[model samples]
Target chain A: MRDIHTSAITDAVKKLCMEANWNLEPDMLRAFDRALGRERSAAGKQVLQTLKDNAELARTKRIPYCQDTGMVVCFVELGQDVHVTGGGLYDAINAGVSEGYKEGYLRASIVRSPFDRVNTGDNTPAVIHVDVGPGAEMKIMVMAKGGGCENRSKYKMHTPADAAGAKDFIVECVKTAGPDACPPLVLGVGIGGTFEKSAILSKKALFREIGSPNPDPALDAMEKELLEQANRLGIGPQGYGGDTTAFAIHILTYPCHITSLPVAVTIECHAHRHKEATL
Target chain B: MSVTTANDGIKDLSTPLSDQDVASLKAGDRVRITGVIYTARDAAHGRLAPLIEKGEKLPIDVRGQIIYYTGPSPARPGDVIGAVGPTTASRMDRFTPALLRLGLKGTIGKGYRGDAVKAALREHQAIYFGAIGGAGAVLSRFVKKAEVVAYEDLGTEAIRRLEVENFPAIVLYDCHGGDLYQEGQKVYAREGA
Candidate 1:
């Protein structure tokens, strides 16, 4: 059994929060380059170039890439054999979030309650998901999910016979979101799970490298088709209109009850910031 | 600040835009704004309307000025302000008409305005411009100066007065009811798909 200290977890989360905010991952940079090559609209190309430049500037200046540093979403794969010491897992993660947002000069965008709408000041109490697996290592992945794109995410329950409608539903969601959700989006599609599980799966799918193909051949083909259809909508970069509305579409699936065909689409903006570390 | 003229096809605009100035802009016109604009997002807008309804003085004179829907990150020492990008504008649709009625010349944000906002722009001779939504770090370079003008307790949501130079934007909605989002989509949307 590998004993991991909570302090180490806290330190990793803190560094990941700041690093993810300030720097664009290589996959994201490559995706930007790909979009720049194919974008037909002058305005669209200009927006793409500016985004690339912005990424570089943020890295060099240690500035948060976007003003909305986003609410941190974390996924942890904890091994049964690994024992956590010093504190509760959640306490450590939240401590890291609070410190990272404050120390990194990132925005504290969380509100204490939806109704009262008071600022949380420290951007804490992250949305954390944990799965226990057989191994001696603990893996932590983090995503700074922005509220604007999160607001546009949607889920649908289809009768098993109507599962084919998933593609159309995703396209419709993008159409409805239009320019609001920040086009040049990366769509994470989750298929065939319980309602809530599908939503979580969709978000988790976004942590995959931007241009990488899904491991499953069937899901990989579906992603390609959905991506093509979404881009054809001409939402473009920032929805000013162009050929590159979405850079990629990633799909994940789980076997569901015979009656259920649940699908969820989680829209991610171009500043798709995520990072992971293993302990 | 010296203004860049329209010779290269980009219009140079300044704050406190006059009626004629607003009328001259059209949907899809690229522009670079120079001079001062104010920042306000959800929380700040919530406060402004109550003050207007109460017939109380606002913390800043908003007449003929532009409001950017933004909540910037905290600035590091030696920086004027941190990554200050426009937020989703539709969230402010509820309070927009009121400000437009009070001589608000334009608003800078990302995304579409509602039908009522379009009507208000037409009635008031104002405009709506969109900056690249996620390009906050690049946009911050344009903001040469920034100061919290009101509601400091709201933190980043506080109203800030910013002096910008050559801040790029595209006119999304003009006073004449031209809508860039609609027109651009029509032009670029693949036929028969």
Candidate 2:
């Protein structure tokens, strides 16, 4: 069995938080370049160029790419053979987030209570999801999920009989998001699962690198089709209207109960920042 | 790092904006704003409404000023400000009409405004400018200086007085009832439909 110290987890999480907020991953940077090359509207092209420049500045200066540094969402893959030491896993993660936000000067956007509307000040208690696995290695993926796009995420439970209708409904989410959710968007779609499971799957699907094809050939085709339909809506970049509405569409599916065909779409903005580390 | 400036026919205007400045702009016009503007978002608006309702004095005189619906990230040491960009404007719709009635000239944000806001803008001869939604780092370059003018406890949502130079934005809504989002969509969406 392998023993991992809680301090290490905390350090890793802190570094991931700061890095994700300040840097745009290579996949996202490439996606922007592709969008710039193909975008038909002058406004859309300009917006893409501006966004690329912003990413460079954020990285070099170690400043957040967007003011809404976002509420942290973490996915942890824990191996059964590894023994955690020093503290609870979640406590360590939260401590990391607090330190990262403070030391990095990232915005503390979390509210202690939704109704009271008070800022938590530290940006703590990340939305963490963990899964146990076979090996000794622990993998953690961090996402600074923005409130604007998260507010636009949608889930729908469709009758299994209406399988043909799924694509249209998925595209509808993009239309409804329009300019507000910040396009060009990266759509993470979850198909087939229990209601809550589908939502989680959708959020997890966003971690996939852009320009990468879905492993499942069937889902890959559906993702391509959905992307074409979404862009056709002309929401464009920041809804100024253009041919490039979304950078990519990612779909994750699971076998569900025969009665339900649950689906969820997690809308992500152009500033799609995520990072991962394995220890 | 490059920033948006008044060039290639992009009109440049200063604040506190004048009546002629409002009248000259139309939907879809790209313009750069220079001089002072204020930042306020959901929490700030929530605080503003009650004072306006009770007829109490506001912390800042909002007349002829543009209120950007933004909550900027904290500035790093020695930096003018951090990544500061527009947030969703529609969330501020309820508080907007009151501000416009009080002689607020414009708002900088992203997304569509409600019908009430459209009507209010027409009635008051105000404007709505849409900044690039996620370009906060780039946008911050235009802000020559920033200082929190009120509600320091509110942190990022505090009202900040900003001195900007050639901050670029598109006129999404104008006093003359033109809507850039609608018109722009109609042009590109026709092919898709």
TM-score of each: 0.98, 0.98
Q: Work out candidate 2's RMSD over C-alphas.
A: 2.4
Show the lowest summed lDDT stretch of 10 residues, model 2 chain B.
Answer: B1-10
lDDT of 1 by residue, B9-101 (tens): 999998879888998889999999999999999999999999999888889887889999999999999999999888999999999999999
DockQ of candidate 2 (2 decimals): 0.70
| Superposition error at A152 for model 1 (Å) | 0.6
Best by lDDT: 2
User: What is the C-alpha lDDT profile of model 2 across A1-279, one tens digit per residue?
Assistant: 999999999999999999999999999999999999888898888899999999999999999999889999999999999999999999999999999999999999999988998889989879999999899999999999999999999988899898877777888899988899999999999988798889999989999999999999998998898888888888789999898888999999999998999989999998898999999
Query: What count of clashes does model 2 give?
Result: 0
Q: Write the per-residue lDDT of candidate 1 for residues A40-127, one digit (tens) a residue.
A: 8988898999999999999999998899999999999999999999999999999999999999999999998989988889898799
TM-score of chain B of each: 0.96, 0.95
Q: What residue runs in model 1 are displaced by over 4 Å at the alpha carbon?
A: B1-4, B191-193
Q: What is the lDDT of candidate 2?
A: 0.91
